[model samples]
Target: MNIKIGNNNKISSSTIANTVNGNMEFPKKSWYEKHPIIGGIIVSVIAGVILIFSFWADIVKFIEGVL
Candidate 1:
């Protein structure tokens, strides 16, 4: 219950009240809650980036061939 810091300072844990409220609840939202089209576009862009990175060498080769 008691914690000692440097130079003989002691703090009792029993005195401190829990600041976080147990009654609080976070609102759950679906992916399309904000905006479906915009969310889809964002997800598509992220997936495209991941795919590009996954096959970067092939993409570079294709670009080089076209150029």
Candidate 2:
């Protein structure tokens, strides 16, 4: 199949398919494969970081309004 990029900035469909095919074949198990506890800890830490950053913006907005 011939795939064309509209603006010449996109990859061809075959390239995408080839790159993603291996990932699609296997279920993602890296999150719990080696060590469940460590994986959970890592996930929790990442989630906490994201939560903190998310609220940081709100905190900044509140501070701006108050000041």
Give a tens-digit lDDT track for model 2, residues 12-59: 544444344345565667747958999889999998988777778889
Off by over 4 Å in 2: 1-31, 54-67
lDDT of 1 by residue, 1-67 (tens): 9877645785555545668667988798887886889999999999888877757888889999999
- The most accurate candidate by lDDT is 1
Local distance difference test, each candidate = 0.81, 0.76
* Model 1 whole-model lDDT (C-alpha atoms): 0.81
Candidate 1 ranges beyond 4 A from true positions: 1-31, 54-67
For candidate 1, the C-alpha RMSD (Å) to the true structure equals 13.0
Q: Would you give me the overall lDDT of model 2?
A: 0.76
